[model samples]
Target: MGHDTVETPNLSFGRGATPDRSTPYARYVRLDELHSLQHPRSKEPAELSFIVTTQVMELLFDLLRHEWTIARQALREDDLPAALAALRRGTHAQDVLVDSWDLLATMTPQEFNSFRSLFGEASGFQSAAFLHLEFLLGNKNAALLAMYDGMPGTQAGLTEALRAPSLYDEALALLARRGLLPPQEASEQRYRPSEEVAAAWRRVYTEPESATLRPLGEALLDVAERVTRWRQRHLSAVKRTMGGKPGSGGSSGLTWLRKSAEQDVFPELWTIRDGL
Candidate 1:
C-alpha cells in the first residue's frame, strides 16, 4: 500500500493572512536551527549535557544584556519605574543562570575529563556575549578587547559597548542629577570604587523614606550580588571538576576565576553598608 501525502491547511488567527502550522512557530523561533546548534565534539554522553548547558548560558547572557540596555535607556529618560522593571527582570534571568550550574555540577570529574580535551582552545573566557555583559555592568578592560581582533562583528559590538556609558554610569548620572552624588570628573574609563560613590549610597540608605533612589539602589544591589554569586559558583564548579590545573583554553583557571569572583560588581553598594 502506498501512503499519500497531503498538505496541511493553514491555521490563521485574527488579522492578515493565515500562517500554516509548519511555518509559523518554527519560522519565528527557528527551533530546528536552535536545536541543531549543539554539536558536541566528544562521543561521551556527558558532553551533550555540557554543551547544552553552555549554549543555554550563552542565550541567557544575551538576554541579560538586552534587559540591562533597556534599563540604561530608561534611566537616561528619567523613567525610574521602567528602569527598575528591567533590572528586576534581569534578576530573574540571573536566577536561572545561577541555577544552570546544577546541570554541570552533576558531571563527575571522570565524566568531564572524558571530553575536556575535545574542547581544544575553547573556553568560557572567550565568550564575547559575556564580555559585553560585563562591560555593560561597568567592568571594562582595553586589553580584553584584543581577544576579538580579527572578528570585526564582535570587535565592533565590543567597541561600542566600551565607549557607551555603562548601566552603572547612567545610574551615577541619575544620582548626580538628583543631588545625591557629588560632582566628579566624567570619564569613560573602567569603573573603580571610590569613597565619594560610597558616600552617595550612604545618603540613599540613611533616609530611605524620602529618597526616590532607595529602591533603585536596592535593585542594583540585588543584581550585583546575583552576578557575584554566579562567579563564585563558577569557581566552585571549576574547583570541583579540575582542581588547580590549567584550563583547556590557556586560561589561569581557578586562580583567575577566584580573583574575578572576589571583585564586587557595585563596590559602593556593599561598602556603604559598613557605614550604615
Candidate 2:
C-alpha cells in the first residue's frame, strides 16, 4: 500500500523548540502567534477580554463569509443540497457569533471607558471582514468603498463583493431557473423587498412542484434569523457598555446599530411569512 502526504502550514515561530509538553500541538495551531496578537493597551482587568472577544468575532466573520461564498456559488450551479449544507453550517457559525456577545455582555460602562479611549479612532465599524460578510448577504452599500481607499487590495475585494451576485441573489436566480420568476440579475444596490420575490417565496411554501425549494427557503430563513439575533446582541452589548455614546471612528453608535438591527437580512423572506 502507498501512503499519500501533504505539506502542512508553516509553524515556524523562531522559538525553535520549547520545554512545554504541548509545544507540538501549540506550534501546529500557531497558538503562540494567536495569543500574542492580544495586546492590552490598558492594565484594566476587562481590556484583554474585550480584545479577545473582538478578535474571535472577526475570525468567525471570515469563516461565515467563506461558507456564504461557497453557498452562493452552489446556488448559482443549482446545487440545492450543497447550498443548504453550507447555509446550515453558516447558521451554526452565526449562532456561535451571537453567543460571543456573552463575553462582553457584563462589561460595565466604566470598564469599557477605561480602555475605549486607548483604542482612539479604531472601531468595529471599520472591519472589512464584517463588511464583506454584509455584502455577501446582499446588503451592498457602495458608499462604503471610500472607507478602504487607502488599502487597494481591500478596496478591490470589496468592489468585487459589491458587484458579484450575493447568496440571496443566487438563490433568487435558482428560483427563476425553475420558472418561479422571470430572469434575475446581480445588483450592486442594496436588496429591496420585491413583491415578485415575496410571491415566489409564497409559492415555494404552497406549490407542490416547488417542494424542493422549501428546505432551501427554511435554511435561508434560519440564516436570516441568526443574522438578526447577532445584530441585536451586538446592539444590546454596546448599549449596555456605552449607553448611546458615540462609537469610535465617528460612527453614531446606537442610532446606526438600531437601524441595522431593525433591517431584516432577508426582507422578502420575512414578508412572505405573513401570507404563508
Candidate 3:
C-alpha cells in the first residue's frame, strides 16, 4: 500500500508577513491609530487643527524627554561623544517643537474664541510632560508638582524626576570629574552659574583644542540655545493666543510663561558666552 503524503502551509515568522522595507508603493506607521486620535470637541474646522497641533507638540515633548534622558546618562558617564550625539538629537527635536508653535500662531482671537470655552481650565499649564522637561533641565519648583496631586501617576513621575539630577547638573559634574571645575562639595552651594564653571567654559571656548573638551562644551551650548528658543516661541504663542488672560492653571498666563522662559537651561554656558 502506498503511504499518504501530507504538506503543511509555509508560514514566515518574524516581523510579520510584511517585509521590513518601504517603497512608493507600500508604507507602514500605524496611521490608523495616529489619525484616529484627533477628536475635536467642536465641529469647527479650526478645532481640528488646534487639536492636531497640540497633539503633535505633546509627541515632540516626549521625544525631547527621551533625548534628554540619554544625554543626561551619557554626561553622567563622562562620555562626551555619546553626550554630544544625544544633545544634537535633542536640538533637532527642539527645532521641530519650536516650529509647532507656528501652526497655532495663525489662530486669531476669533478662531480660538470658538473653542476656547470648550477647553475650560484645561491648558498647557497643566501639562505634566512639559513640567517634567523643565525639572530635568534644572527648573524645578515644588509648586509645579502640586498641580499633579490629583493624578497619582503624574505626581509620582514628576516627583521622581524632580529629585533626579538635572541635565545641567550632570554636565557640571562631568566638568568637575574632568578637573575643569572646582570640587563638587565646594560647588554644591550654587551648582548653577558658578563663577568657576563659567571661567572653565570660557577656557574651553577660547582654547578650541583643550583636550577634546570644546566639543562637549559647544554641544551643551547648543542644547541651551535650543531650549531658550523653545521657551521664546512658547511665550510668543501664549501672547498671541490669550494676551493677558490668566492661565487655565490659575497663574498669570503670559507673564508667568515669560518668567519661566527667562530661567536659563544652562546658566554658565550663556554666562561664558558673553566673556568669550
The regions of model 3 sitting more than 4 angstroms off are 1-28, 185-191, 207-211
- Residue 137 of model 2: what lDDT? 89
RMSD vs true structure, all candidates? 6.6, 4.2, 5.3
After superposing all C-alphas onto the true structure, candidate 1 shows an RMSD in angstroms of 6.6
For TM-score, candidate 1 versus 3, the one ahead is 1
Q: So what's the TM-score on candidate 2?
A: 0.92
Q: Which ten residues in a row have the lowest lDDT in candidate 3?
A: 183-192
Candidate 1: pairs in clash: none
Candidate 2, residues 124-155, lDDT tens digits: the string is 99999999999998999999899998999999
Question: Residue 202: error of model 1 in Å?
Answer: 1.0
CA lDDT scores, all candidates in order: 0.89, 0.92, 0.79
The global Cα lDDT (0 to 1) of model 1 is 0.89
* Model 2: how far residue 131 lies from native, Å: 0.2
| TM-score leader | 2
Worst 10 residues of 2 by lDDT: 12-21
The candidate with the higher lDDT, 1 or 3, is 1
